[model samples]
Target: MNNVKGKLIIIGGAVDKGSFTEVSFDQNVANNLNFFETGIMKRIISESKHGEQSRLEIITTASVIPREVGPEYIKAFAYLNAHNVGVLYIEKREQAHDPEVLERLRNADVVMFTGGDQLRLTSILGGTEFHDILLDKFKNEDFIYAGTSAGAAAASNNMIYQGSSSEALLKGEVKITSGLGLIQDVIIDTHFVQRGRIGRLFQTVVGNPRTIGIGLGEDTGLLITGNGRMEAIGSGLVIIVDGRQIKDTNLTQVELGKPISINNLVVHVMSMYDTYDLHTHQMEIRNSQYSIPLMAEQDSDDADPKVSADDRE
Candidate 1:
């Protein structure tokens, strides 16, 4: 994982661009309205090798409304003074092989995937030469791959395609499929908190205990580095569901519509600036005045352990 040369900015749905209205659950609507207006886009540009001067290609393959979505992003980037941006409306599978499209992808320093249907994204571009080029650039260069909503969900090796939040706990309610395979060992879900999708992730992790479940809230995202370091960004919460400690599960034994049970599933709630180490399965909270590293075990007698922030420095 550390050998990966690219960066991934996986965002939850409805990233604020100062134009659209977003539904809020436990978050302040006013705060979320401006949360990612500049923060997320700025971070995306700064993380790229050439910053704002980098050639950005916005792939609208997942969206049915590419005309509207593409222009919105172009305007959004222009607001941040990023001028070298273009949109690729690859709606068909054969379009993915277009020489012009291939050249644009090859020359781009950053590629942004817009929100739409995840299945459309995988079905059209999964096994094409275009996908091969994308995988190559990501593995060999300092390329940045950023996505929002459905785009974020498809970034993982495994994806949840069909599942309702309310019934996700029932056996067979959550459907899983192979995704773009840009990142591995984890399943990503977007619009998580606001949509009450925690059950969806819980079911996924319960069945695939080896894969971690990342539930991203609206306007929030994770800045994942090559070394497996994930930094929570934006204004809302990011939930990490770890099932490694599970002692048992009844998912396989239950019927299709039956409710399943699992034991010892661990969860971590994170906000902006918090960091989670994918390799270590540890988390460091930054909002607290002192850095509290949550580990599997700690010698401290307190139920919740604490350590001086300076100690980590």
Candidate 2:
């Protein structure tokens, strides 16, 4: 099995969705669209180059409705290759589950789940022999992981999603189901604003008043280190609802059919280049990349292509 310790990135939605339509499969051009301009994501790719992390073993668990993952998904590898990082993808048999898929997942260096239907995702992959092997892979080093949209939701111990229905978020309308629990204890909702999932996310936080709810909008993502530090990266913001310190919630006051009005809940909309300290549950503006010294940047990226691993500083 591939070592698993390293940085993790979880995107909200819009992962490699539009690139396949392009006639030319330019790795650079296609790659640029999938990743953000923020230095945090760059750092994830950069660290992998120097062995501070390992290869990205991407897993697309969602959109199993015969969704195709072609050359476009490998674009991240191209970005890594430019920086001299290796990459690989686990091939799945079309139209059904492949038994060996679990073994491949166990040995991945960096596992990533793709976007699609949340229910379809869990229905197929959850509680299966495949999901268990993937979980076993969670305990090694030189490996990282990531996910997007429905993929992001699956990272949490409990996931928020609309399975077969297109229901807007109301008081009790939000549905919660078991996730793979890699991230553990948080519930995730993707395509937040565009899908109007705020009310549903609120319903989730207010109802429990103990779990953290992370709602990621499209084209946005959270870049996190294993030490409980995370930076918000992308063009938009990540909405965080912390109910751990809540005093009261009227969720149970309303019946199952009614939409409940929530009050006094603390919410924050974090911007890009900002860091969230998960341990302290605080948010602060991260130092700009331009502020770091040239030597610091190079030392962080000092993986010489011509030298052997023994020669690395």
Candidate 3:
């Protein structure tokens, strides 16, 4: 992970695919900006080794309506002049072993997963040869792994499968399982602010305090590259919940249906252009003229609280 050559673009649900259904909003105010205009997909292309010529593959294994979802992405990429893109509807585990499928994946520069049920993605593709190839490429090559919604949720090492937003505060209400292991020591949750799922993330981090929780708002995403450096993208917010400083928690002592309690949980609200270092637990806010450094722990009483441009690397 220290020398990771690949990149991850984890997007929240409701990304604009050129349909223009509705303009993006921030804090309930219409921004009239879409993902296309915001340059999210364009960033994906630019980050790739081949730029627009990169062979992009869309995996719709998580989607129930792959036919509908797949075409929309194709059009979206086409609108960006990326014509080499294709969709792979791998609905069963058997399809994951197909030689042709593996070959196409091996040749692809970017492989993106579409939104649906996160469990479906883990169940069908967890131990397949296809999964192995993707993992190897991501670790060794200059690959780009992008995902949206359910796809984004399953990109981390841990995934939340069954959890109701309204009842997430109670013990055993938020369910978690092993994910694709694309990223370690982190958990991703999508459609965060719009669905009011911060409580779910809170419970998860409380249970596993070492893990970092990311709540990505709709139309928003994190562009993670090179040793856990994440940059917020799109129009909405990205919430980072850090439980490393937690002093106490009643989660283990609570009953299954009882609400849990935790003390000293730290949270940082990030917007577009904000950067966070997962390794060092440092944050840099770009919206303001000064760079606000939210460090995990102060080195000394006189340590500068501001993050300089050199500290970002």
What TM-score does each of the candidates earn? 0.87, 0.73, 0.87
Ranking by TM-score: 1, 3, 2
| Minimal lDDT window, size 10, model 2 | 16-25
- Candidate 1 TM-score, C-alpha based: 0.87
The sequence of per-residue lDDT tens digits that candidate 2 reaches over residues 9-66 is 7777643342221222244555435454544345546555244344455555465432
* lDDT at residue 126 of model 3 (Cα atoms): 98
lDDT of 1 by residue, 45-97 (tens): 98998988999999888877777667767767776788999999999999999
Q: What is the lDDT of residue 300 in candidate 3?
A: 51
| Model 3 root mean square deviation, Cα atoms | 8.4
Candidate 1 deviant stretches above 4 angstroms: 15-38, 289-313
Clashing pairs in 3: none
Candidate 1, poorest ten consecutive residues by summed lDDT: 18-27
Show pairs that collide, candidate 1: none
Task: Provide the lDDT at 4 for model 1.
Answer: 92
Q: Is candidate 1 or candidate 2 better by TM-score?
A: 1
Instruction: Report model 3's TM-score to 2 decimal places.
Output: 0.87
- Show where candidate 3 strays beyond 4 Å: 15-33, 289-313
